[model samples]
Target: MAGLKKKMTIPFARVPVAINEQKYVQEVLESGWLTTASKAAALEKKFARVVQAKYACAVNSGTAALHLGLEALGVKPGDRVFVPSMTFTASAEIIRYLQADPVFLDTEYGTNLITPGILEEAIALHPDVRFLIVVHYGGQAAPMVSDENQAGILEICNKYGIKVLEDAAHAFPARLGERMVGSLGDVTCFSFYANKPLTTGEGGMLTTRNKEIYDRVKKMRLHGIDHDVWDRFTENKPSWEYDVVEAGYKYNMPDVNAAIGLAQLEMAAEFRAERQRAAMFYYEHLGQLQEFMDLPVTRVPFSDHAWHLFPVVLKEKAPLGRNEFIKKMAMAGIGTSVHYKPLHRMTYYKNRYHLDAKSFPRAEKTWQGNVSLPIFPYMTPEELNYICKTIEKLLKY
Candidate 1:
């Protein structure tokens, strides 16, 4: 057995920063246009092209993108939105922000994403569902389009006048049968947070094919202004006049952040390849521990994974409990995280929605055993080997 490292620290994620990231940011700083200006606009254009979406709007965070997308989808107070309980709180919290209610759905066993069967069941139970937020869990694209039936999630939702919004926080560059996630639904939200596949310090983007939604999001993203703030200063005539079309939030991505995003977007393909390599490394090595742990699904039907996270689930037969295993890894200077704790299991959501563990059997069980290992694009081979060997050693203890 390889000896444990006396001291080392592998972070859960180290945000990817490209060589040009600093150059673009420096240009933005010297230009003195700090708000959502040229770089932000450039990022929006570049991201839309990359994701094959007709329109893209950059926002301050993934949560902002969801909130704005929901508002544009015509989600109203008291409306019922179907959301997966296994996602981060941001996915469902937006429903509450609009004074609407969330009908939490359980995840599919293998993919850990909300499947069509579960969606159908939720529809059967809550026929009044007007909106749905499908999160591509663990960077694996959820089956938005189905082969089982002609009517996929979008088609079914359209049939009943239910709008679909995709929370693609973990699924940037992920695809479903030639269609990228950003173009898969009515409006798809992508996170550019430090830990996501792409990072802009703190930013996100909303993509869509609907021109109306795009226009609304653009106007509403920055305090409902009729014209972009940049237009006032950047124009040859320098017009300062503008109108607030409606009450909106301050959710515009700054030039500095967007500069970083533009660089990140440019290097997305390379970053994805590296991350995928890391995922493959884990998959190949972790298979030997199947009796002790269950690894994430690397492949999904009709979809390509972005490999943003590598989550492992400890089985009942494991030598250590989930928490115990995490502690042991920490002692070896390795960091780990739980992708989620199932929103329904959280105190705020559970108490408010009258949810119990029994409400979502799969998600509850998955939560109990879930542990996310480091799988960033920059992770070294030595780091990967150390992680795997450490797990092997921990299992024996």
Candidate 2:
């Protein structure tokens, strides 16, 4: 029940900081064809190549990418998908699109993905689980789905035929083994919002190695058109010849947005370097504050972190709780936020799923105290130091 010992103001996130984004937008302005056409196609190819996915389909938002991924992977109205309680609602919300239910799985205190043990337990108990949705919260990789566990989960899912979808919205360039995030799970998703590692203002991509899933998602990303709309009118093709294979949402990413994404993607290396640098600075500096906070643990041995957000958990300390600490930081001009209130605890999810607040102790405690401090590619080192110093001064009582 205490406050930040004083006042200061720091931003949480600022948009479009990628090095080559602006020039790309200008080039797109002159490219003539705009909407989900040429630029979008090229971006999809570049995105697939970079992420190492056999196929990639650009869409309007991370949520759209998720929805399309689910649809293509055969999510149905009566299906039950196991999802982490600790992720953004977008991860769970897509399940509702299929009239399917999200069976909220708890997260470990140190990272966002659902536990392999609890997942095994859940799979055993719920024979109806048709899919597993793993969210690598704040750019951290999902805990490995070991061969044994994979066989277990996949066996059960395969018995009833279930698919695994990974919500990699934050874990963009993260790796697992020799594969990148987008290629890790059955289908993985990435975001390009104004605030992501790569920003297209508002866009996302869904990736998969499975030909059927990828092809279907590609169609679903558009209006479920049997073929690419851009190709439908290309050269000598008749404009009126197209088929609505199956009704789908208008989630396609436009060429202009792809133009921005193309530019941002080109600079992914530099962008990734800076974000990791910012995280390392935060980790090196903030890790010393163990008396006050806990840093997220990385599972990837040589896995590259996209370092999307530097979420630190405040340990039990003198005179301050999580919410109070956030208020104090805000008062001091340092912007901060809790990554999420566990999805199960939200009114709609609770009412629908009958999810009790106390069901996920780890995720609950994590959400209650987790503070995502400002970490971005554009943040100056001095700014980061100022934040650490500011928090240091504040913890004094």
Taken over the whole model, the C-alpha lDDT of each candidate is: 0.87, 0.79
Per residue, candidate 1 scores C-alpha lDDT tens digits across 1-397 of 2465536789888877777998999999999989889999899998999889999999999999999999999999989899999989999999999999998999976578887778888888988788899999888888778675545777777777878999999998888888988988879999988889999989999999999999999888989988787867677645778888899889999999999998888888888888888988888887899999988865464237888888889988998889988888888999999988888878998899899789799887788789999988878888998899899887755
User: What is the model-wide C-alpha lDDT for candidate 1?
Assistant: 0.87
Question: Which candidate has the highest TM-score of all?
Answer: 1
lDDT of 2 at 213: 89
User: What are the clashing pairs of model 1?
Assistant: none
Q: Which residue window of length 10 is worst by lDDT in model 1?
A: 296-305
Model 2, range 72-121, lDDT digits (tens) per residue? 88888988899888888999999998999899888878876666667877
In candidate 1, which residue ranges exceed 4 Å CA deviation? 1-7, 148-151, 234-238, 299-303
**Local error of candidate 1 at residue 78 (angstroms):** 0.9
Give the count of colliding residue pairs in each prediction: 0, 6
- In Å, residue 136's CA in model 2 sits off its true spot by 1.5
